[model samples]
Target: MGEKFPEIQGGGSLILAWQVRNKKVLVIGGGEVAAGRILNLLNADAKVVLISPRDGLNSEVAHRIERKQVEYYDRKFEPSDLDDPAITMVLTAIDEPDASTQIWKLCKEKRIAANIADVPPECDFYFGSVHRDGPLQIMVSTNGNGPKMANIVRRRIAANLPPNIGDAIAKVGALRRKLRVVAPGTEEGPKRMQWMSKVCLKWSLEDLCEMEEQDMDELLQSYAPDQIPSLSQVRLGEEPGTWQFDGSFGWACVV
Candidate 1:
């Protein structure tokens, strides 16, 4: 007899950060929703080509056009617009459902990614509420279920994050680069990964946030050739038994 397996639950969307910098994306409509979409695209460095009658544009989008920030065509979306093989994506925010659907179908035919505003079933992607700091972006997605809920969760997370968290990331990134130079190449790959994991598990977020150039120099000393220092030596005077990791923010704490 064939072995039985437990029933599988529903599927999930694969969340990812797309690289759209300098890529041409077609935008339809110029209302409030489209205005928001345009700004999001611009933030990603996407070259936006907006198609809507001049009067359809909101004050913000209109100003953007005048400032030459967006490539504008004061006309309705035409199927021919998709012909610009350079337009790798299209987003529609017009009130016309039929028009939006047609745009989606055209994108499908052309094998281009598309996001049809307010129409989940037809969208190739959904925008999430994003929390941003210098070189840091955290996106919360509800998979088109509840955008407002995503925003609430994002806000809560932003409020709870330790101060100077982004600064910590930047400093750690510099340490990582230094380590790569010191260790150099795949010869130290396994040891390097192990050391990095230990660092995260042992160092509290506040400790990392407070990391200085001198602290980093001392930390690297622990990774000297043929030696991986124990917590007692590398963690200063802190005991390993008192360290804990809080999963809520995925940071270390001293309990």
Candidate 2:
């Protein structure tokens, strides 16, 4: 038998309490490894800049840089590379460990957070495989030690996601204002969350609309600030349907 695989590793317990949209992220690499990290940053809408001298790299990467999808510098990184005011984080996968270490040191001295692909001790952060649905982003990590495993888990989880998830999120977001209007008190927060979760689990537009109307009716009896809403103890009801989605994400139910 082999070593039992860990359920998590490296930076698994980490959670992003803040959003990273439109932030600047720098990468110093030009190979397939760098491509994976770069693609994730792009998906997160970060302003990504890649520094590498390699020409005729992956065709799509070359095309994207040329099209200004990302900025590319056909040169090696320098000590002064940490100059971008907008750059809050950096990731490096350069072949030279010493060079990566030095770059990480420079980033730290300049107060920019950095992560090195294979140097976990030097990394202030770790990369993870991510799947997103509208405003919901799921990131899987085995720290930096097992990105492949993380990716495998990510794909499994993604396969279970219904195609309508994004649309369902959009519909739910549209209903929030109506929810707030009906449940006009701090006491309704938990009940409202429960209701939203119910609507999301069903993933039905008609059911969500009906839930919205029901919420409106429930809130018709406006309560004062100290008044306890009837739904204060309300629990999300039973799921209405069995999803046709894959079962690999069974673990996510507990999550």
Which residue pairs show collisions in model 2?
Answer: 11-143
- Candidate 2 on 1-255: residue-level lDDT in tens? 888976854434566744567888888887777878777778778888888886635666676687888888889998777886888788887789888888988888898988888888998877778888776678887867787899999999999886655654555566666667867699889777665554344334444333344543443232222221222211232122321222222111110
Q: Roughly what TM-score does model 2 have, to 2 decimal places?
A: 0.67
lDDT, candidate 1, 1-255, per-residue tens: 799998975755888888889999898999998889999888899999999999888999998899999999989988989999898789999999998998899899999999999899999889899988765789998989999999999999999987687876777677788789889989898887767766665666766677777667667766654333333345473333433333323354221
Superposed on all Cα atoms, model 2 deviates from the true structure by an RMSD in Å of 8.9
Global lDDT scores for all candidate models: 0.80, 0.67
Lowest lDDT sum, 10 consecutive residues, model 2, at 246-255
User: Each model's TM-score?
Assistant: 0.77, 0.67
RMSDs, each prediction?
5.5, 8.9
lDDT of 2: 0.67
